[model samples]
Target: MRLAELQGWIVNILRRGSVLAAGGLMGAALAAPQAAQANLHQRYRHVVRIHERLGGIASPAASGPLAPGIDWIVMDAATGRILSEHNAYNERFPASLTKLMTLDLAFHALSHGRLNANTPLPVSPAAASVQPVKLNLVAGQTVTVMQAMLGMTTLSANDAATALGQYLGGGSIRRVAAEMTARAHALGMERSEFRNPSGLPNPNQVTDAYDMAILARHLLLDYPQYRYLFSVPSFRFEGRTIPNIDGMLKRYNGAIGMKTGYTDLARFNLVTAAVRNGHMLIGVEMHAPSWIVAYNRMTQLLDAGFAAESGAPTTVIATATSPQPRAAMPPPPVRQPAAAPVLVASRSRTAPVHMIVARSVGHVTRDMIPGWTAQVGAYDSYILAKRQALTIRGERKVGIARVGSAVVHRHRIWRAQIAGLDHNDANLVCSAMRRAHQSCFIIPPSNESLAMR
Candidate 1:
């Protein structure tokens, strides 16, 4: 036996000298010393149980279930403090609400300049095949990224969900779904596991009310610029005008558009948010028996939370419209004119590195000029590659004149480079760039030109 175990036995024997004849107790101590420690762990659990399960319900369960097995929560959107919850962490099917993560990834690309709203997204047979609650896209038909977002949001289009996943995953739906799960973990949605982008009936997919509230909060706060995407009442696409199905957006007084879902298994899932008097509350209801029950319960919770005179001072209500009934969709995205910001070179200490602005869509072409090149990073796809190059170019406007892509090891990759420079200039540029904490390497610029030729 280990020294510690032996000491425990001796202490037990000394404490109960007359009980030595009860050899069973001694044997139990020797064979199951861990049982004693387990009690201590139980005590420890009681102490630590005072804290929450990280991002979880913080308020009292003031009310009971609206219906059997219904999970719901009301959270202060700004502080993310749970004002009220009921079975909030019980795992349940999410229905079409899975598109939130897919849309989250799309917005990430948009804000990072990796995707433009107008970028044409092709619909593959797999993407087109997602049934019911779908956009009915045909194989090989295409829609812009914004159009897809509209379809997904206003109509809960499963096809749009699949298309966005494929577009973001670079033609791999499974990879995008995996990315969604990883992103959910990173966001601290501990009770969520998504199997598909459209939240279809998958035995493996599940999430709870607490996790949905977390996602709803992030969707509102993280990308406020894209908040406009969620609220449109109707969108005219092709020949049909698709109307948003979110009843909260239609009827709730202060409600903004969030999402809605329904399946025999998931059964009336809705995530709704509202703002009144500079206060916001997000409500999530999953697996309600009927849509009426879900919305009524949600309305009751939101009404109580909003009416609570708790005077919470940490929250700033989002000022965007509730995405309620609105007539025309927002205008199509137009390219903003490039700022003509001049780059004042810092002290040129022999070798100077400069980050250049990306050329505007209408800028002068540098494709004809080619020599050696130096770049910072390689991208997995040409679109992402070009986007990164454009980002740095637009932000700093330095040595980046041309961004190019090549298939390396059978995988398409993009390189951020200072093109059109001679060998000496390229080396100098790379050395200077390295000083700025950017890794750089020179590419055979002439070889790329020849290959393109």
Candidate 2:
């Protein structure tokens, strides 16, 4: 063929190839969005089912007048199947029940020869300073690891926890906390995190009923030898006697002691295990309105579990099957924007207004600080700002600022910025604040802004 003929053919081929590639690209572009939408829809369904089966949303009993304020979860100890759950995954402070993980690590150390039950653990100044409900160990004093374990499990001793943490962690409390968190994750307590060895009131120290249940189950199943520690009625150590805080040990039949914890944020949490007719059940409740309420709720859970077992046919040894695996689903789609805020035209109708103040340093996260009021004001100097900031160190931040031509004084601000948080997350943060008795407001930054004079 002539050069001109060959060139014409090559151009034709190139044009056809371009057309095919463009068509393929268009097809992919069209298909991708639909696929994403479909995946999102599937995920929504999965979440709904999870909420329903897990009872993480609203409980059936919550509608009744006698509904307990505590969030309760009960599960078959053998199979790890949830038997009855109410707010099973509702997040709450773990309190001293945090020691369960601490004890778990101690046991691991024993197993690994890093430490033994009879190992002498020295109480440091840090350990002796941990707040009350303690064994009252003095700094530089020594106690066996086993004694500390008993003190922690039976008496919920903060001092003992500190000593044990120091001993097991080789003198660094931070390392112990890190190991505790890592172990919690290894045990699949996904909803839980630990910041301290003892369940002190750290805002970051938090766990949920589901996660507690998981930990309790592991303790009962994986570490049966340590089970007796939970049942001790009292511990007498260092010239002080402390009684176990778990009421179920005395009140409930077949009750096995696990752990009890309380804090303003956690509001009384308990993990109780019971064995009835060879069937073991574990119950967890967090944020109960009162200690008595927590006890009653666990009792009810145990009764229900026993009743279910009794109803099952004997000799057949029927096992509760694991719940069906739900399909893998994507998370809920991004919510559409809300309707524009209504502007009232009538004199009687007023626009809803919100006020915010800076939080202080050392103030528990908005979720943990209770009964906090914001300081409103405009400031002119960094010195004033710094002083105000120091005052609310743990509760809020103080800074110089002006809002809409108003000279605000000593305004408190949140140091942490939650940028682009979704509605659910925002609501969660708000709820946490309310639970902790702190005040919070959502503020939208202005497109145009100016520094305060």
Best by lDDT: 1
Report backbone clashes per prediction: 9, 25
lDDT (Cα, tens digit) per residue for candidate 2, span 293-351: 67777887788777766795333221232253333432232122232122111111122
Q: Candidate 1 at 404: error in angstroms?
A: 54
The TM-score obtained by model 2 is 0.57
Query: Could you tell me which residue pairs clash in candidate 1?
Result: 231-323, 355-398, 356-397, 356-398, 357-393, 357-397, 357-398, 358-393, 358-394
Query: How many clashes does the backbone of model 2 have?
Result: 25
lDDT of 1 by residue, 135-158 (tens): 568789999998899888876877
Q: How accurate is candidate 1 locally (lDDT)?
A: 0.62
Question: Residue 407 deviation, candidate 1, in Å?
Answer: 58
TM-score, each model? 0.56, 0.57
